[model samples]
Target: MIDHLRDMGLGVDPVCRVLDLSPSTYFARKTRPKSARRLRDEELIPLVTAMWEDSGRTYGARRITRALVRSGRQVARCTVERLMRELGIEGVIRGQRRRTTIPEPAAPRPPGLVNRRFSAERPNQLWLADLTYIRTWTGRVYVAFVLDAYSRRIVG
Candidate 1:
């Protein structure tokens, strides 16, 4: 409403009076000065944005602030955080682990392979086998192997 009145060339005092507000309050708000901190934030926002993009948008506020300081540009960590929030920039979040093991009922159980007797008289007398899971860039992979108790050689 104040802007509309000003558009018609009317002074703020008259506008405030018509709007049932004190002219002093309206004038004080209209002539209010911005603090140095606010001005610095406004100025630093672009710098922070540039640094964030330059880092391939992978760095969070803490790292971006450190990079800025290292580059001779002084700024606060909190300031970087605020700027990142305003620019809608965020760090990547890692996902949780997924279970990949699946037991088979008819996988053919090789009798008490070790028979609780881990010792072997000769090289490949007793063998033990086990299965485990591993994660790779492609996906989860299962690995099974057999080892000889005596010579400790991987039979399979």
Candidate 2:
């Protein structure tokens, strides 16, 4: 439409005015081209994209920048972040985890024979036994271990 208007001897400003477009908008479209800086950014985008993928998408901007620097490519963190944003890439966010230990009131409790002081004067003088659970496809499996505190050996 702009080309047709221009060929008909109507200047871009007058055509844009007739079409209800601002002068700045018309001139912006006319002057916009593949600038050297824009071309460089476009070229660097693929490099950044490959690096982001090669890291299994786990690295944030800082790590990606470091990886680029390690590979003899000096890149800034903000640059990596901007390229990642322009490429529609994002970093993974890990979720916070909680401890799984739970106290069992119904299970039998063994007496604290050592009185919480684990030191034993001689080998075989004191032994400790504990049972724990392990998860498997079949369900939870119980494991019992007997230990000699003095020798630090698994007696059973």
Candidate 3:
């Protein structure tokens, strides 16, 4: 940015001052050599890209790190992850999603037995039954109950 401004007749010193940057610091940054980590990253970019492509793009960071280590390459999983993100590549997640309800459109439908009404003249006149499940530490616990509509009480 400073270079662009300098090219457009603005002095580096004045631009640095307006941007709250010291001119000397800006000049030093421009002259400074690339850091060791940056150079290493540049070297590793191609290797990571090749490894990712070799896996048919189905290997994520963890798997990629393992493959690199098996091939005698000392690289961290996080590094591979970062490189993969920079390369804009990711693994394909293979699995079927669990579906609890799969309604059949062609099947005959059951009538609304209660007709959306819950009132009753007596205690046992109207009862509503419902079934549901709850996930617990062990597994899913299915629960079924009957409620007396007139008294608004759980009968079972």
Candidate 4:
């Protein structure tokens, strides 16, 4: 990355300063040998990509790690997750999410007395009442409101 920046006309010292790194440290790291972990990651990148593709691109990190273990390869789930993130691959989530607001079948229900009619011939002839709740820092606050149908204004 530093080399790329340098090629783009940015000086090494300024770039290192912006990255909170010393030029000497950057130079030392640039010449340092690849660590074991980095080498292992390089070797595993292709295997992870192949596994992901073989699964029709529907296996997440946990499943990929399990598959690798089953195949006699020792690898951590976190490592597989990181590799998958770098590869820009992910599993597809299937099925519909469960609804949390299902109405009770046994509960008594109110009759539709207004027959879905909201308009009124005159003010005060018909009023609509609704209950709603809001979440706040303190807690949930419940609010009830009454609306004049003819005027279409909040009465309470």
Off by over 4 Å in 2: 1-33, 97-156
For candidate 1, the lDDT comes to: 0.83
Task: Give the worst 10-residue stretch by lDDT in candidate 2.
Answer: 93-102
lDDT of 1 by residue, 61-148 (tens): 8888898899898888988888888889976556666766567997987677456888889987778887887888887789998999
Task: Identify the leading candidate in terms of TM-score.
Answer: 4
Note the residue pairs that clash in candidate 2: none
Candidate 3 clashes between residue pairs 3 or more apart in a chain or in different chains: none
| lDDT winner | 4
lDDT on C-alpha atoms for all candidate structures = 0.83, 0.83, 0.89, 0.90
Clashes of 2: 0
Q: Write the residue-wise lDDT of candidate 3 on 78-113 in tens digits.
A: 898898899899988866555656899999998998
Which candidate would rank higher by lDDT, 1 or 3? Answer: 3
Each prediction's RMSD over C-alphas, in Å, is 14.2, 15.4, 8.7, 13.7
Write candidate 4's Cα lDDT for 69-136 as tens digits. Answer: 99899999999989888888888786555443589999999999899999999899999999887766
Worst 10 residues of 1 by lDDT: 92-101
